[model samples]
Target: MAAQSKIPQATAKRLPLYYRFLNNLQVQGKSRVSSKELSEAVKVDSATIRRDFSYFGALGKKGYGYNVEYLLGFFRKTLDQDETTYVALIGVGNLGTAFLHYNFTKNNNTRIEMAFDADPNKVGQEIGGVPVYHIDDLEERINHVQAAILTVPGAEAQTITERLMESGITGILNFTPARITVPEEVRVHHIDLAVELQSLIYFMKHYPLEIE
Candidate 1:
C-alpha cells in the first residue's frame, strides 16, 4: 500500500524515530528487523509498531522479519530526503542561537539558510554561518527560503507566522508557546521543549514503565 494512505498525525510524528532507528540498523549491518526490536529501540509498544507499519502494508512475515535496507529505502522516499529544505530562523535568542549552531544539517536534508531578528545588535551578524537580518527585512529575506523556525517571544509568534505565510514560507518549526495558525498548504510543527520535558518528567514520576 502507498505510505500516505496510513498517514495519521500520530503515526506521521513517529516516522522520524523509525527512520533514525532503521538508519542505525543499516549502519550496524543488520539485515532484518522485527516489530519488537523497533518497539524496544523507540520505546513504543510492539503492537503499536506493528500497527504503524501496517499502514505501509505487510512489512514482515509472521515468523521472519522486515529487511532493514528495504525499510530504510521506504522511509527515505517517504520523507523526501532527495530534496533539501532550506529553513530560516525568526529569532536569535539563546535557544534560537543554539538551533543555528547545531542546525539539523546532520540530517543532510534540512538546513537553516537565514535568520531574522528585531534586535539591532543581532542584525547584520552571522550565527553559525547563517546571516541574521532585521525583522523589517523578514518578508524579503524569508522569501528566499521555503521553511522557518520561529523562536521569537510568545507575543511575537502569531505576527511573525503571519509574515512568514505572506512571504511564501511553506513549513514552520514553532518553538514559541503561541499556536499560530496558517493556511492548509503550510505545515507547522510546534516544539515546546519545556512542556515536553515537563510531560516526560511527570510520566517518569507517576507512570514509569518497564523498558521491555
Candidate 2:
C-alpha cells in the first residue's frame, strides 16, 4: 500500500469504487480485468482509471489486463480491509440513528461501535445494537474508538471537533454544514446533504428531461 499521505485525495476517494467493482469481478470468477472494464463498472473514464492505478505503479500489462485476485489482494491491503475500523457517532438523532441501524454492513471493514447524545430518553440505551452514551462521555467513549461520524448541530460542530481532537480521534466524517479545522494529520471528510441536494437540483434544472 502506498503511503496514504502520498496518494492524492482524488485517488483515495476512488479506491472504494474500484474495490467494489473488483470484488464483484472476483465473485464472478474473473481471472483478469481491463482498465476499460473497471471504468465502465465504476463510471470513471478508462484513462482516469489507468491514471489512478499508475499512482500505485503498473498493476496490469497492456494486453493481459489486471488479475482480479491480485488486484483484490492489493486493494484489500491498501484500504485496510483486513483490519476493522471502529467508528463512533456523535449524534443519535434521526439521521444518526439511521446510520447506526444500517452501519455500512456492505463494507465489513467499518462499523459504528457507539453513539453519543444529550437526550435523556435516548441516553443509556442501545440503538441498532450500539450503546448510546451521554454527550458528556463523548471524549471518554471516543478515546476508545479510532474515528467518528459527526452529526451534531452546526453550532456545536467546532466544539465537538475540538473535543474529538483532544480525545485523540484521527478521522472524522462530518455531516454538519460547518467546516471544522483540525491538524493536518487528522482527516475530516464532510458530507453536506443540503449542498448535495442543491447540486442535484441545479443540474436537473439546467438539464430537464421528460418522462417517456
Candidate 3:
C-alpha cells in the first residue's frame, strides 16, 4: 500500500465505499469486477475509480479487472478493519440518543463505547447498551477514547470542543451547527443536517434530471 498521505482526500474518503462493494461482491460469490461494474455499484465514475486504484500502484490488471477477495484483503489492511476504534458521544439529546442507538452497527471497526450528557436524569444510565456519564466526568472517562461525536447545543459547542481537545480527543464528528474551532493537530468533520438538506433541495431545484 502507498502512504495514505499521497492519496487525494476525496479518493481517501471513497476507499471505504469501494471496500464495502467489494465485500458485497465476495459475499455474492463474484470473484472479479471491472471498473465499470464498480462505478455502477458505488455511483462513482469508472475513470475516477481507476485513478483512485492507480494511487496504490497497480491494484487491478488491465484485461482482467479486479479480484473481489484480493481487493477486499488489500483494503482490509489499508483501513485497519481488524482494529476497533472507540468513540465518545457528547450530549445525549435527541440526535445524540439516535447515535447511541444506531452506533455504527454496520461498521465493525467503529463503535460508540460511551456517552456524556449534562442532564442529570439521563446520567449514569445506559442507552442502547452504551453507558452515559455526566459531562463533568468527560475528561476522566475519555482518556482512552480516540474520537468523539459532538451533538450538544450550538451555544455549548465551542466550550465542549475545547474540553474535548484538552482531553486529547484527536478526531471529532461534530453534529452541531456551530463551527467550532480546533487546533491543527485535531481533526473535525461537521455534519450540519439542516444545511445538507437545504443543499439537497437546492440541487434538486437547479439541477433537475431529464428522464427520457
Off by over 4 Å in 1: 201-212
Evaluate model 1: give its TM-score.
0.86
Q: What TM-score do all the candidates reach, one by one?
A: 0.86, 0.88, 0.93
lDDT of 2 by residue, 87-195 (tens): 9999888789899889585855888899999889999998889999999988666767889899888998999899888889999999999999999999998999999
lDDT of 3 at 69: 77
Candidate 1 per-residue C-alpha lDDT over 25-129 given as tens digits, one digit per residue, 9 for 90 to 100: 888899898888888889999988887787766468767788787777777777877677788998999999999999486654888988889999999999999
Q: What's the ranking of the predictions by TM-score, best on top?
A: 3, 2, 1
Tell me, by TM-score, which candidate is best. 3
* lDDT of candidates 1 onward, in order: 0.85, 0.86, 0.89
**Residue pairs with backbone atoms closer than 3 Å in model 3 (clashes):** none
**Ranking of candidates on lDDT, top first:** 3, 2, 1
Which model is ahead, 1 or 2, in terms of TM-score? 2
> Per-residue CA lDDT of candidate 3, range 1-212, in tens?
35567888898899889988888888789999999899998999999999998886646787789877777776787787878888999999999999999948474488899999999999999999999999999988988898999999999999999999998899999999999999999999999999999999999999998899
Q: After superposition, how far is residue 99 of candidate 3 from its true place, in Å?
A: 1.0
